[model samples]
Structure formats: structure tokens, C-alpha cells
Target: MATTGESTDTAARTGEQYLAGLSVGEREIWLKGEKVTSPLDSPELRSAALSMARVFDLQHEHADEMLAPSPDDGRLVNVTHLIPRSREDLERRRRAIELTAALSGGMMGRTPDYLNVTFACFSGRSDVWARRGNEEGAANIVAYQKLMRDGDLSTTHALMNPQVDRTKPEAEQMMGEVSLHKVGENDDSIILRGARMLATLAPFADDLLVYPGSDIRPQDGRYALAFAIPIATPGLRFICRDSFSKQRNTFDYPLSSRFDEMDCVVIFDDVEVPRERLFLDGDTVGYSEVITDTGWRGHIMHQAFTRAYVKLAFAFGLGHMIAEVTAVNRFDHVQEKIGQIWNMMELTRAAIVAAEAGSFEDAGGVWYPDERPFVALRGEMPKWIPRANELLQLIGGGGFMATPSKADIEGPLGPEIEKYFQSAGADATRRIRLFRLAWDYLGSDLGGRGELYERFYLSDSYRMTALAYTIADKAFPASLVEQFLED
Candidate 1:
């Protein structure tokens, strides 16, 4: 507990300061074969970085909405730190998710604090976990939570291991093969090697949080390790691929206008992490069971809802645009399409809200979202939302497909374009601009990938549901099972 000005030191730290401090790693990053002095300076990464900093600034600018005081230490903390002691706590946590999601415009926007709470809720009652908890695991959870509360830093997760060799025995997973293993310890730190893909915010985070995913095989303990390292630590390089924004020329691209930031493949080339930051090491079986079932599903489901909300917002607005442009706004079919979009939106919201409301209390006076509704919703919604996007897309039609460049308006073809393609009542010029806005998502990066993402998301959630079932053995009543078998 540092004093108020410094009290929690975590409390007063704003998004701007965090972005300023990120310069330490900028010198190490290279984009397009050139080094950058401030990673935040690049247009592609800058949007995401600014988005990150905006979150911090938001804490100050919208303190009541973005933060809450943690009861554990009376420290003013981001709502990401909230542990639902009751349904109200759970609702507050969901609202926090909503606020941040809205702020990031639902673009890959969770801060490090998101994972911090998972570690908190379970770790706070490490004793129940210890009910049978290995003392070491208990200690590990507590230590991790402390660092979390201190706002020690931002971190990204490496959950999806790169699929390198499917033909090999599950025992020998060797895709480019960058997994953590104990090489030898320096006097003060542990060294890690091997690389992991899709660290969602790794490119600009202070630390990288590597933990075992359910996909990890127990024999592959080397890959089961969990820990963190500074973004510029020796031997760690963010061998990130080309930016998604780089995939296009800026003039016609819309999703690239302000989205697609902070995701990259982080390659750890035998990097060393200070001991204090290490939470779990070489305990794959333990890490898998703990992570996959312990509490991840709840947080993960909550995190995805942010995207759902964003997509819904797009649909509502896009639906109306579609109806108006097609001269069918007053038509029953068009109105029905619009209604379907709203129904899907409300459905997703209900799932998220219900999951939070039904959360059960835990022993430490803390509460956690119950898995049944969440798991059910997680399994069902991803499958449902793509249809909404599909409806939005179908209604959009050729207007969605023939998106013209923004520069076209200023070029020689401008006058000819205005003469032919305008919507019913609007001028050709106005229609082009409106269609372009629709094209941004309906035809461009956000739209093209959105429905696919929903399908992928639904498919992924389906797998997670199976994993939960496998872990909990279908939440079966074993005593009754044996009795039935005997009879």
C-alpha cells in the first residue's frame, strides 16, 4: 500500500504514462526492415497502442465507470480487479467488460488486468484449491495475485500452441518448436525458449504471460510452463508478421481505418525472466486442469461478449442503412430483417447477463459466474451470431460488394459515378459515401471476416465446451450412476 498519490502506485498510473513507458521496447521492434524509436509512433501499431493508453486515460476520465476499489487492499483498482462477492459484484464486473469493450470499439481490447482477476478469484481461495491444493500451487497463485493487484504490468497470453507436427506422437509436438523449458538459471532469473503464436496484446505489453493451454499434452511438460518476461528482455523478439493494415492501401480500407492492432506472434529466443514474475513452470498437467477448468471459461466467455456487443451495434445501424438504401425501409421483409438483427443482439446480451446474475458465492466471500448457463451460452451463441451477420450482409447486397475508393470521389470518375449509383432519395455522391461506410464492415475487413469469425468462435467455444465436459466428466452424479449399474 503506497500512499494515495503513490497509494497503490497502481491507482494513479494513467494510460498516457503507460504508453510513454512502453518506449523501452520500441527500440527492439522492427517493421518493414527498419527499426523504430517508439513503437507507438507507427501508424499500424499506434492505433492499438493509443487504444491501450485510452483505457488508462479512461480510468481518470471516467473513473466511476472504469475502476473500483479492491477490498483486498483498499487500493483503487480497475474493475478488472473486482471479485464478485455477490451478484452486484458480478454485474459490476460485466459492466466493466461492457465499458472497456465500448471504449476499444470491441477491437481486441482487454488489458492485462482481465487475466489478473481469474488468478485472483481462484487464488483468493487457493485454500479450497488446496482442499487437496499443493502448497506450491497455493503459493504460486497468491504470489501471482499480489503482482496482479500491484498493477505490476500489462501482459498477453499464448493459449493456442502452433500446430507444427500433427503426425508425430502427441508427446512430441514440434511445430517451429518454441516452448519454455528450464535451461539453467542465472543468479536472478529463469531462461525460456521456443515461441508461441497469437499473444493478443504482446507486441506492446510490458510482460508476456505464457501458461499451458488445454491442448497441451501432459508429457509435453516443457510447453506447460507459465511465466512472464519484459517485452525487450534479452533473447525475446516479437517476430511479429506483417500488420493486417499493411495488407491494403489505406485509401479504400475501412477496418484498417482504426481497428486491427496489438495482435502478433511472439518468439522467445531463449529469453530470461526475473524469478518474481514466474507463476507456474513445468507443471503442464497441473496447469492444464487448473487453467482449463478452474475459472478460465467464465472469464473467456465474458471476454467474447464484448465482441458480440460490438457486432450487434453494427447490425442495428447497418440494418437500417440497408433498408433505407434499398428503398425497402417501409417494407415488411426489410423490417423483419432488421428485427432479426435486434433479436440476435438481445439474445447475446441476455446470455451474458444471465451468466453473471446466476454466479454462485465462493468460500472466501467471493463470487464466481456459474458455468452451466455460461457454458451453455458459450456453446450456443457463436453458432447463432453468424446468421445475424449473414442477414446483415445479404440485405447489403451489391451495394456491399461494389465499394469504391474514397479517392474516387475526387478523381476523374467522380462525376460519372454520381450520375449512376445514388440511392433512392439521396444523391449519388451521398450514396457513395454511405455505401463506403457500409463497405467498411459489410464488404471489407470487419464484415468479410466477421461472420467467419463468429463461425470460428462458435466452433472454438464448442471445443471448449467439450473440454469442460471431459474435465468435469459431464458433471455426473457418480453415486447414482453406480446404483443404476448395480440394479
Candidate 2:
């Protein structure tokens, strides 16, 4: 509920301005082995890019809820970039994150706001970087936070090492087979080479952050680095996976047609990261500490939980609608299936609310949402998402496969198709539209990709469970139970 000082005075741009910025960039991107001149060149990529731009436009309209006054200047900036020092600030950020997730129907995973919170976390604990005797690195973190906040820049990240042979250690693997590393550094910049996997939304973003993933050993020093660079940086190329947004008819593939954020393998063929952009270099302890000790993980998890909640709500609503159109809402078994989805939705909603309600301040005076609910949400979502999709498929029955195409609805068979496809309460067109949407969400390639994304979005399941257990152990120490036991 914090409005901008003036529409013209705000730092954020409208959706059109964001699109124009992307159109002029000379970034390298490839899909299906061909070089793409720009994301706008492909209809699918362009739709995804436009969908992202709408997030910025939403910020402009709801500036009071989304924007907060910058510390250095009076210009209103995004709440995502706010470094929360009080409980109210945390609540404000939670509201902003919810609004953005709702705008995209919780499908746009690498929205600019995600990284905004990352930089905000770094800025809050800038001294952690300073402790490495890299004062410049500390300054860079603060400056980059201001730069992105004031400019409203969109960013994606490539944190995972390239998935090659997991048996070999990163240090032992061949240079190209391992993750990105610094091969050379000059007085002004460092030259990076090698590749990083699964840079989601890289082609559509304004910048990319290259950072260390978890469990990095000290021997992997060359690969332990953190920095940000423009997407158009020379030698920085994105080799993309197939685009799911390629659907021409929005009605047939409603969600995929607009929300397919193309995932890619970001290749850095000697890309130059200027000294000013470097946040960490060869400091394995510092690199690991920055994420674990700075409350950054909690902040990022907060955004993820909020987004997942919206997605669950969307899925639940779709299931309910499907039951109505199919006239199966009356059946006891069908109602029970719907009830299962409803229960998951309610649980997710409770996690989001509880996380915020139990928010507490960290050692640095930054208020973070309670980690327990977030960790639980992360652990449960992988299972719940697939089950929810299965429920939709079950309720849909053969209708998911038998739905008519857009062309069929408008051609010679239109009348016959309509007469036969009409359901109890809905006409043929209405029934077809609903089924098509459900198919796109549950049966299409897009839906398949989403299931995979949700399953591993936070990382491997066993690792996540271990992490949750570790947190719980510390919060409720095992020694407490020993005192009550009889010897």
C-alpha cells in the first residue's frame, strides 16, 4: 500500500518500454541449431517476452503496492529491491511478490523480481562480501542493487554446473566439461569460459547472474565465482531448448502460448565480466557463506512459495471448472478427487500465510519469513504438483484427447462437431475451449515441461528433504528430548 510519488517520477517503465529495450539488444541466442537475431524474431519467444513486459506495466498501475521509495533518491523503485529492516517492509515485499505471481498465473519462473530480491539480500549484508578483503566486491553489490532497482532491469541466473559426469569431481573434470570458470583476468576485467546449465529465461532477460551452486568444495575455486553481466555481452550465447510458446492458436494452448520461458544452456565463450560487476572471486568459504548466512535463501524461498501458491490456486480452479463442464461434479468419486486438490491448495495457502506471519529478524536486522513453512512447502510441492495434474487428467477422462482443434471448429465439420461435443451445461465451443485449456495444462508438451520444472525447481528431492531436516534439527535440538528420557 505504498504508492509512487508521481507516475512520471517513478523509476519503473511501462510494458512497451521494456519491449523496446529488448528489441534493440544484440544478444546471441540459438534454438534448434540456428542463431536467433532476437527474441522478438520468434513468435513464441516474442510472446514470452511480451508477457514479461506486462509485469512491469502491472508495477506502474499498482505502484503504491509494488513500488517503494529508493534510499538514495526519492524516485519510487520496486519493492522487490527493498532491503527489509522491519516487519512492515517484509509484508510490503510479500504483497508485491503476490501481485507479480498472480499477473503471470505463476508460470513465469525467472521474472526480474526473483533476482531483485537476490541483490537486495546481498545489499542488506554487504559487509559479508567486505570481510573477504574485497571492498570493491562489497561496493559492487550495493551499486548493482541500485542499478537494477533504479533501471528496473530484468535478470535470469545460471547457478548450476553443467550436468556432465556426476561421478567425477568438478576440479577433476575437463575444463569444458565442468561449470564456468575464470581463465584469465586483466586489470579491468576477468575472462570466463565454459558453460552453465538451465539458465531459465536468459534469452528474454536484460542481464544474467553467474553464481555458485551448493556443496561446492574448496578445490573448485576456479568455478566458485559470482558476477552479473548484460545479456548482450560478446561471446555470451544462449543455446535454447524447444519453445513451448510456439502455439499459434491461444485458445488451444492458452498458458503455454504466453508463458513458455525458454530454458537454455548459457555458454560463455571467453565472456568478459568487468571488475565492477564481480561480487566474489575464488573465495569458496565466502561464496558459500553469502547464500547461507545472509538470509538470501529464505528471501528467494519466500518468492517461490508465493508463486507456487498462486499456481496451485489456478490448478484447483481449473479442476473445479472441468468437473462442472463434464457434469461430473455430482458424482461422489469425482467430488472426492476435487476435494484432494482443494486440500493441497488450502495447505499451500496456509504455508504462505504462516511463513509471513511468523517472520523474524536475522542477525543483520533484516526481517525474513520463517524458514520452517517455506522448507515444508518446498519439500511438499514436488509431490503435490504432479498429483494435482493427475487429478485433472483423471477428471477429464477421454475428453483431453478427443478435443477438437481450432480449425475443426471453423470448418465444414463445425456444425456436427458442435452438436456432438456440447456438454450438460455448456455449448460445444465452451466445452471445447475448457477441455483445450485443460489439455494444454495437463497433457501437452508444455504441461510435461512444467511438471519437470516443478519437480526439480528447487533441486533434487533427497537433498531438499535433508536440508529441511537439518533446519528442523537446529530449531528443535535433539538434546531436548534426551533430558526427558529415562536411562
Q: Considering every candidate listed, which one attains the maximal TM-score? A: 2
| Candidate 1 Cα misplacement greater than 4 A, ranges | 1-12, 30-37, 109-113, 125-141, 167-171, 175-178, 215-218, 246-254, 363-365, 411-421, 425-430, 446-462, 465-487
Across 1-487, the per-residue lDDT of candidate 1 in tens digits comes to 3345433534535877788778875435656676554667787677667667866677677667656666556567776665557777667666766766666445444465566556666565655434333565467657776666556356666765556665563346654254445665787777766666566666667766666565555566666556655677767666555665534444566455556554556666667777666666666556656654456667666666655676676667777876687687787877888888788778777777777767776546667676665666666666666666667666767776565666676689888777777778577766666666666654555555545555553247668568557656443578667777884
Error of 1 at 54 (Å): 2.3
RMSD of each: 4.4, 2.1
lDDT (Cα, tens digit) per residue for candidate 2, span 1-487: 3245534468887888888878666889998878886788876688988888888899988988988777776678889898887768877887888899887677777788888888898888888887769788889988998898898898899988776877776776775445788899999999999888888988888889876567578777888789999999899999999888855778777888888888999999998999999998988898888878888778888888778888888788888998998889999999999999899888877887787788888877778888788888788888888999999989989988768888899999999998999999699998888888887776788889888988997896677888888777463465677667857
| lDDT score, candidate 2, position 446 | 81
**What TM-score would candidate 1 get against the native?**
0.83
**Model 2 TM-score (2 dp):** 0.95
